[model samples]
Target: MRELDVAKLPEYVEEDVRVSEWSTVRVKHCAYSVPSRLKGKWVRVRIFEDKIEVRFADVIELACERLIGRNLCRIDYRHVIWSLIRKPGGFARYVYREEMFPSLVFREAYDGIQVLQAGTKGDLEYLRILHLAASTMEADVAVALSLLQMAGKAITSDAVKEMIASSSTSIDVPQLVSPAVRLSEYDALLTEVAA
Candidate 1:
C-alpha cells in the first residue's frame, strides 16, 4: 500500500474482518476510525507500511464483550468510524469523529486516586455523581468538584434538579432532559460520530 489522500483511502482499506471473544487487536500504525461497537472484540489486521484496514463490525463486537467488567481500558465499539492507533505510553486512546467523552477517563483516573484506592461507598458515590454531572453541557464542574471535597458525595439527578428548582443553593439547574445526548447538537464538534 502507498500513501494516499482521503479520496484514495477507501481503496487501501477493506471491511468485514472477524475475531474471537475476550481479545485485543493491535492497530499499531496510522489513524482511522473504527465502528464504536467494536470496543472489546479482537481484530486480526493485515497491514503494510502504507495502507491498513480493520474493516469489520463483528470483529469489534467480539473484542468488546471480552472486555466487559474490566477496569478502565480502552475499547472500541461499533460506531460509524472504527479506526484505532496504539499511542505512545501504551495508553490506547479510542479516536473517532464522535463519542468523545473524557468523563469516563476522568472517572477511571479518579478511582486511581490514592484516597479512593480502597474504594469506599462514598468515593464511588461522589465519583458517579461527578461523572454524570460533568458530562452535562450545563454542569458546573468546578462546583461539583468542590462539592465532592465538602463531603457532599452525590445528589441523584432528581434531587439535584429539585435543589436547583427549589433554589436550595445558588446553583441553577434547568428542567429535566434526556440523559442521552444527540451528537448533532454539540457546537464544538465538527464531525458527527455515534456512541
Candidate 2:
C-alpha cells in the first residue's frame, strides 16, 4: 500500500455549528449543552464514536458523552443554571426540567424546599441551591443537604452554605509525628540471623 499522508486522518468527523440562544448545539438530531458563554457563538464540534468535543478557536471548550438516539439531549445543569437563576420561573416548565437535577439528593432538596416554601419562592430557593452546587463542589453541597434534611432543618441555599462552611471549619487534622529510626535493631537482627 502507498504511504499514508504526513498527518493521519482524524478518527472524528468535524463540523462547524452555532450555539443556540439556549447554549446548546444540535448534532445528529440531538441537542448537547455547552457553556452559557458560548451562546450564539460558532464552534467546531468533533464527533467521535462515543463522545463529542466542542472547540472554540481550536481550543476544546466542552466534551461530553454523545447521545445515541434522535431527539435526545444531554443537558448539564452547570451550563444552564446561571440563566435559570436569572429567571427561576422558567424552571417549572423548562423542556429538560428533569435533567436539571444533578442527583436524587438535589431533587429531594427541591422537594423539601417546596414543602417549606410554596410556588415561585421555592423554585427560586432551589435554583439558588443548584447554582451553589454548580459553583462549588456538588458532593459538599449534597452532604450539607443530607445533613440538613436529616436534622429537620429548613433547606435553603443560605442554610446549605452555612452547613458547608461549618463542616469545612470543623475538620480536625491530627498532627503526625515521625518515629525515630535506629540501625542498631536491624544490626542485632542481622547478627542473630548469622549466628
Single out the weakest 10-residue window by summed lDDT for candidate 2: 3-12
For residues 71-135, what per-residue lDDT tens digits would candidate 2 score against the true structure? Answer: 99999999999998999888889988999898999999999899989888999999999999999
Candidates in order, TM-scores: namely: 0.29, 0.83
Question: In model 2, which residue pairs have backbone atoms overlapping below 3 Å?
Answer: none
Best by lDDT: 2
Question: Per-residue lDDT for 177 in model 1?
Answer: 75
* Candidate 1 lDDT (Cα, 0 to 1): 0.38
Top model by TM-score, which number?
Answer: 2
Q: Predict model 2's lDDT versus the native.
A: 0.92
As a whole number from 0 to 100, the lDDT of residue 51 in candidate 2 is 94
Error of 1 at 148 (Å): 4.3
Error of 1 at 141 (Å): 4.0
Taking the tens digit of each residue's C-alpha lDDT, what string does model 1 give over 66-179? Answer: 122323234332222112221221212323312323345334334434244343443344334443443442245434443443554543333444443444466678898769
